[model samples]
Each structure stands twice: as C-alpha cells, then as structure tokens.
Target: MPTREDPLVSFKFGLEIEGKLTGFFTQVSGIGSESEVIQHKVVNSETGETIMQQIPGRLTWTPVTLKRGVTSSMDIWEWRQQVVEGKIGEARTNCSIVAYAQDNTEIARWNFENAWPSKVVGPEMDAGSTNYMIEDVTIVHEGVERVS
Candidate 1:
C-alpha cells in the first residue's frame, strides 16, 4: 500500500468560480471577457502541503452530448450573486487552474465534471451571477514507474 508521504500519492482536484459577464462585453483580458476562467489549487489534504495553484485559466462550455456525458448544475447561482455584489467573501473566479507536484516535479492535471454556466439570464437580460461550483475534477497522477 502507498503511504501518504510516498513520492507519489493519490489526490482529488476541483475548482471554484464567481461573478458574471454580459452582452456586448468586450475582451479586456483572458480568453475573452465573456469567457469564464476556471482556476485550480492543489494541496495534500492529509499532509497539508501546498501542491499547486493555477490562475486565470479558460473554461469553455459546449453542448452536452453522450460523448461529454456530463451536465452543469444550477447550484451556485445565489452564492455567485453574493460574490459579485460584494456581499460575500472572496470567491474564485471562473476557470482558474492549478496543477499538482511531487518531489519538485509537476504530476497531476485537474479537470472539472460540469461544463455549463450555473447562472442563466436574470429578470431582464441581466447577466446572471455564478458561484464557483467545482465538481468531478479529475486528478491524473503520473505513474510511479514513469518518474525518472
């Protein structure tokens, strides 16, 4: 069995997002202003070692299909609204990313389960708020034998 401190250990990864982008929005930065960014952060949950942190990474949404086999949830709407209105604490912006490291080398890629916006258009063409809802993030660790 692999110990927690082993050079290679298992990990679960995910992300958080907040705020919204509306119509006629122009790209000031990132993939595009309307485009959401999913950021990621990694830590050894058991050991508490900071593994990695990815910021301002892009996350795009496309039609759900059998090939994708996933659905977006409407869970984070309220929370996202609070975050955007400055009524809540700091929330991770959309699609920011981070990776994991082992023995000073990068070792894992984190991905999300859901791929659609949590918030929909509000009462009147208002850009709906979105809370960073992280789900089913995949953590692909480098196989031990592959390490040099």
Candidate 2:
C-alpha cells in the first residue's frame, strides 16, 4: 500500500475526455495556470516617497496537450473539426487527468471545465525511422481544479 507521502509515478496517469476513457495517451502536459501581475505605484502623502506594488490581474490557463498512439478512431479529429467550423461553444466539454497508485487505485485527479481542442497535430512520417504514430491535441479550457 502506498502512503499519501509517497510520490505518484508520472507514467501511471490516465486521461478522460468528457468523463470517458477514450483511449490511452502516451503523454499529457501543461496542467498549469498563471495570472497576469499588474504593478501599482503608490505615493506617500507626507514623505512623498513612491513605491511599486504588484497585484494579480487576469487569470490565464495554459492549454493542456495530450499525445497518444494513433488509432483508427477519428474522435479527436472530429472534435477539432468542430472548432474549425465555428462550433467552439458547442464543442466545449469537461476533461480529467488522473494519477493512479501502483495498485491501480485513483490517487489524484485534475478536472478541466469547458475544454475544447485548439490544435491537433498528426504523426510525422519517415521512411528510415521507426516510431509509433503519435497524434497530439491541445485543449484550451476556461478553468481547472484538483477534484481529488
């Protein structure tokens, strides 16, 4: 049994698109967000001293990218097509990235709200090299939270 203090392995993570495991992804990245900092200058009335202060402005969420071995499924591509056709709002869906323990027990999960595919990259072809055909999709989301 793994304790809470134990660090979860990165390779044991799972991805769920709209609450369903569509397929196994080889890589998942960009689970982060940042806020724009605004600097404010304050002047003292009595001493006439000026100081700069930093304040939080707008919050921006980084697009999450997922890479998986190419399969016969056209689900990811279909989602991207919707975006290209100006159906972005209707294409928005929730997604989850989950990390599991060695025993396959769910440990931690990050849920993303109103996510849609912003970009999709197909596998590069090479005649001399052998590699798994990988397809990647970048998902832009409005908000993300650690649900478990």
Candidate 3:
C-alpha cells in the first residue's frame, strides 16, 4: 500500500544549452501540500537560445503535492558540449529536492543573470494536479539552439 510519507513520484531531468549561461527559471507545482513536480528551463543570452530544456522521463516514487515554506536544495551543475547544426550546447544536471508554498498570494517571479550551471531554491506556483496529466511547467528559454 502507499502512504502520505512517500512522495507520489520522483525523477531527475537534464537540459542542454548552447553558449554561455544567460538566465534560468523554475516553476514548481504541487498536488496539495507536497512537492509534485520541480520543473525548470534555462536560456543562454549571449546567443539568444535555450541552453537547456527538460527531457521527459519516468516517475518512479509516489508523487506529492508541494507545500509552501518548505525548501528543497537542488544541486545544479552545467557543462558545455557540442551538438548538431554547429550549435554550442550546455548540459544541466538537476539534483536535490525543494518545496515551494502554494498559498502565497504574492506575484510569482524569479530572475537570473550570467548564472550558468547554478541551482535555484525558491517558491513558485501557477497550476498543478496529479490525478490526471498535470501540465504544470517552467519555461526557461523561448529561443532556439542549433548545433552542428
């Protein structure tokens, strides 16, 4: 049987960027009070392209809706690599876990600059659910990256 003590699902993802680190963003969504999904996307400003994006994977552990005031530490690391189309690539490593409050009424927002391969711990929410396919997501870069 499953218990509340266990998170409903847990998994790690990676994002590949091209060029120097420009900025990154995270949007965490919860089911009720436990952390459900910790999603993030990063952008490279120098070349105006997304350095990294989430690569979907399987969720093994039980999923928990994130709660407010709970802080999960994420160990973020980045590395530069090469890809197709002659585009510079960046690899992002996501580690650790954190929780953000969903009861906050303040405007949700976060900003980063020249911070590549960095881990961000904060509270940000929009909309989320676990019953069905929750589209809760965080878009870091709206641009595109092409490497040869």
Q: For each candidate, what TM-score against the reference? A: 0.19, 0.88, 0.15
Stretches > 4 Å off in candidate 1 = 1-13, 16-72, 90-106, 109-148
Writing each residue's lDDT as its tens digit, candidate 1 over 31-104 gives 11224555566888899998656466654433211111123444345445655576543333233222234333
Q: Pick the candidate with the highest lDDT.
A: 2
How would you encode candidate 2's per-residue C-alpha lDDT over 1-148 as one tens digit per residue? 8757866675566778878876667788999999999999999899999989899999999998989889998988988999999998878999888877778788889999999999999999888878988899998999999988
Higher lDDT: candidate 1 or 3? 1
Sort every candidate by TM-score, greatest first. Answer: 2, 1, 3
Task: Write down the lDDT that model 2 would get.
Answer: 0.88
| TM-score result, candidate 2 | 0.88
Q: Compute the lDDT of residue 121 as modeled in candidate 1.
A: 35
Off by over 4 Å in 2: 1-4
For each candidate, the alpha-carbon lDDT, in order, equals 0.32, 0.88, 0.28
CA shift at 97, candidate 1, in angstroms? 3.3
Measured with C-alpha atoms, the lDDT of residue 114 in candidate 2 is 94
| Residue lDDT tens for model 3, 1-148 | 8755643232321222232222222334421112345455677778777665555454332221222232232222112221122333333222222222343222222221222321223434446733322222222221222221
Candidate 2 has its poorest 10 consecutive residues by lDDT at 3-12
